[model samples]
Target chain A: MLITKDIKLADVILQNYHLIPIISRFGIKFGFGDKSVGQICTQYHIKTNFFLEIVNAFNDKDYKPYEKLKNMSLSLTVSYLLKSHYYYNKVKLPFIENLIDSLEWEGEDNLKNKNVLKKFFRQYRKEVNEHTANEETEIYPYVLELEQNYNNTGKVSVSFLEKLKTKSIKDYADTHDELNSSLLDLKNIIIKYLYPAENKDITVQILIEIFKLEKDMTDHTELEEKVVIPVAEKIETELKKRY
Target chain B: MAVKFSFLIVEKSYIIRSGLMQIISNFYETGVVNELHNVDTLLKKLSEVNADVLIINAKLIAAVPELILDIRKRFEQLKLVVFAGTRREADEFPGFDLKISVDEPKHLIVEKIQSLINEIKPKKDNNLSENLSEREKDVVKQIALGKTNKEIGEALFISPHTVITHRKNITGKLGIKTVSGLTVYAILNNLIKIEDAV
Candidate 1:
């Protein structure tokens, strides 16, 4: 359970099945012959520091990535975040929805109950979409603008950016934890209330998918709250100082 | 109905302050314009009164970097316009929502103010369900209630494919693709009861 830079990536994923997607996200594949975490990351051209920070953050709740993220590129971190969004929206969400659709129901109100589960999943998906869309359209553009304004050597004035209605990245951060609770509600509803009669195995599979997604989303938001927001705040401060 | 606009101006110079007030008064038929000579009084007055737009002298913003930021954070809906002697001075105060040069034409200033007023006006929800047919509304209500298309079709005596088409139209009309958002919309517009949504 101890995650260190010297530990094998395979061993880490083996210990925590939830990290399988995280490992695959970096394009790391199986069949490594005793390669260490640092070695495999270097071999695959992944940012070793960023990977380690993410792994540590995932493993230990008290671990903070502030110092490591201070030196990291915001653009790179945003790209990684965008990739995670892709996994959630395109890959994991669709897989779960399809699994739910294929489940066989049993009871007098079987159809009605199944519809409730479907509706819950759909609601969670929508909330996620809205959250990610806001980040992509509003927050990302503002951060990029802040970065650009900070780096410009000339007497460039980003007065227009300042004029925008969006006050700060912190506003977006405030809405981060709302999506997690609804997801937890979905898990509870399925497990406690709606029991699929004929296809219990499929129901279990769907629950496993939900559990994996929940972990992934938790780690993703932690990185955002810990890593991305701080970096953005630093850039905003720098931009202000430059002005 | 004519939209009411309000303005708060913070400028040090008496002549320029009154002159700017005159311009705003002449531009709009009905608006409450308050002028202050100091940032301290301006901040204090803002707490007492509600204004849609805040026009501050750029010099004050430069002297106090946190002035605009503080005002913006405090008043989430207030639009900001910095009146500066030059574009360079305006550029130095980057926190203002807009910049109007002191030497700019009066008509341009009026236009800018008008635009800012329009921008700050509370957006009309435009009755998102107005375009939805009765059938579409029923489908949305069912979706919000966590009903699948198949179940909705059975309840409404329509084909599942027709239910999907209704769903598509509902999303297109409301510009909301998610069941949760549609549920909120339904509840807000009174298309579905709050108890049914849960």
Candidate 2:
């Protein structure tokens, strides 16, 4: 059963995956849709099972899935923003456009739906680009540097991400939590109208595309919380005296 | 089945140059030569793809022993044939199917493919039981465990010099040179468990 809070995220993914029938063709594709839904669910099982795994990690607690779900949604939003350019250019545009064309939506009624889809895409594109620039330019590099130091020395200097002056580690995590809330908002908006359960080629294509996007976004969030932040915190404390 | 072979040729002469081009053309005419520029590039390529056999230039065969270890880890089943210009190079590692320049006619290189094809098992057997005597295997397991030669000798009730001699023989027979390479080989061949080594 899909968790209530995850419903919107699930809807967005299920809808997008419904749009693509080509997922089967990419069975050998190294990542993304080449991966099985079962594989995806297995990877995501930990996060969904104990939502506290994410949010509570930030707060220092045990076994919390709801908090993790919320944190994941926001962390993923920021990550999506960071990688928006690559996603739009490589994945979104080619796959979505090809998907629409494959649907044969040239007729008047279908044209109307296509126009609506285009408008929805426009908002998604703009939001994603803005988010990507914010994270890539401002956030991702800091996290990457943190990861590098932690991997090498098992610590990060306190001032590692101070260039952005985001204040304390707690502040950074709180801001991360805020990002999840925003993502939840975005997900709800997406879930309002996407319907493609007919198993039509277009529906299948959309579902696959959405599934890929959602999975990428989700994994990106998990990377930050599970790996990036904890490593950053460890390094910040270790290098605190040196700086 | 068509025999797919890869070449790890290292010549100071560029592949695009006239003499090298003629050699390449001859190989292409007589056999399928998938040429790699250098040893490092060849090993990296091995990780990304699998091949039936690798025909390495004699110079490359001797130059980067570390890379040979890497290839041995990644492509354990690859049948390696070394075409070296001198007997010294051929004598350096008898474990490889080494052929000196004067002995290696173009037809000899081509004809060797049939045997190499029969040897392409894709993944080399990592079980130490397949080769090596019981005593030699015991010394190798100790070496892989980060034990000193004296410690290995003490454990096995032999002189440190005897342990060293066994190690030299192991390196010569296995064609692996580094401690890390031996570690990888031990793990793969089941000489040592991954946890024990780690």
Candidate 3:
């Protein structure tokens, strides 16, 4: 019963990725990310508020916002890495903000105080988008083949990772590292800017939101390393086999 | 209790999906049809799964002959039906055990399919030549020779597109839709010499 319940929960949890289309719409309201999100949000006619609430909740200072954001960010990172391939347009920086905007709002004032958050958003977005583009253009095709052939062969091979370790994969991983560092720098700025002594309810919410955002960034990177990379490697192996 | 038959549905368009959903809904209420999007998936499912009837989408019937051949060869007992999108397409893939167009009313498909199953019930085995005509066979042979429509047209004295038209006609008749299938047919029928193909 417990395993069944857990499996059901996993199914429900995975369904959240389906809502990326909806969450992406908030990018228009906040001008969060790049043109890619804007284009998709418009085409899909995704509702913004529902996604914004999720983003705000992830970044909320009260409750278990940090842990929640980490879980959410990992889900989102995987979803974006997977879903971006379906689109012809490349996923770029503001897309993350678009994703974040749907999950939690750190409040405008918090963003203003920790201006590094803006810089991080800007830099991280650039780096992440570039990384995503590599995956989309080169890596994703291999992954799709793996998915298509999954029924025939139940194993993932390491040759895909070996392929990734070549120049193309290293370039992507380098960009990921750069973006991750920007996020850490942004976290430091937010910590320095947080003045709990002079805070109000809005300030408290902002701090909680920032904390969640920081935790999420870290979690997102780890998941990409652990799950996404391995999946990509499996895909690479499948691709090599096909070629 | 006349025997109830199972059909596999394959298509990409929403219109086709909705129409199929409606027709199957009317007949059985429990939608047993599988809407396949690509050849690989369809082939895998067809080999692994069992069905009493095969209702192929027109687009798929036009796109993958190897898949059709494979299915027909393997599942000889299953009645093969073509749910073509247009009357022209219906005429193209000529001798399906039962042929119905997507534009046909739900009742029309239901009725035709029902009657087809009853008529061919015991001998559900599908033969590749059921749909091909003598002329269509000639066209496929010419195509396997790697003749351009113009060359084939010059030889057959038909327009290039007409050669194309005949080729399409041949594919429909043989239930072998792909160029590769036509190539294979050309080789098998000794229409094109193997050295010429090589």
Which one is best on lDDT?
1
Residue B145 in candidate 3, Cα distance off native in Å? 70
Give all candidates' CA lDDT scores. 0.75, 0.51, 0.51
TM-score for each candidate, following the candidate numbering: 0.53, 0.30, 0.29
Residue A87, model 2: Cα distance from true site in angstroms: 4.8
Off by over 4 Å in 2: A1-89, A92-94, A101-107, A144-199, B1-198
Pairs that collide in candidate 1 are A163-B97
First chain TM-score in every candidate?
0.85, 0.47, 0.41
Worst 10 residues of 2 chain B by lDDT: B121-130
- Top DockQ: which candidate number? 1
Model 2 lDDT per residue over B1-198, tens place: 112344444444453323333454443222334556666567666655555456566676666777766767777666666666665657676557545353556566555654454454233323333256788889878887889999998999999999988887765555454454455456545688656763
Q: In candidate 2, residue A148 scores what lDDT?
A: 55
- Put down candidate 1 lDDT per residue, B42-140, tens digits, no spaces: 777987768777888888877777777788888888888888897776777776778899888888888877777666655522333436787787887
lDDT of 3 by residue, B75-184 (tens): 77777777676877787775467788867876667887667656655453333344456666667777766677788889877788887777655544454443434554
Task: Tally clashing residue pairs in candidate 2.
Answer: 33
lDDT tens digits by residue: candidate 3, A1-243: 111111222232244443333244233233333334324344445432223334343333222223333333233434543543233124433444443333323454334323323333554555555666776666555445444544345554566445444523223453454544454444433343233323345444544544544454454454456555565555445555564
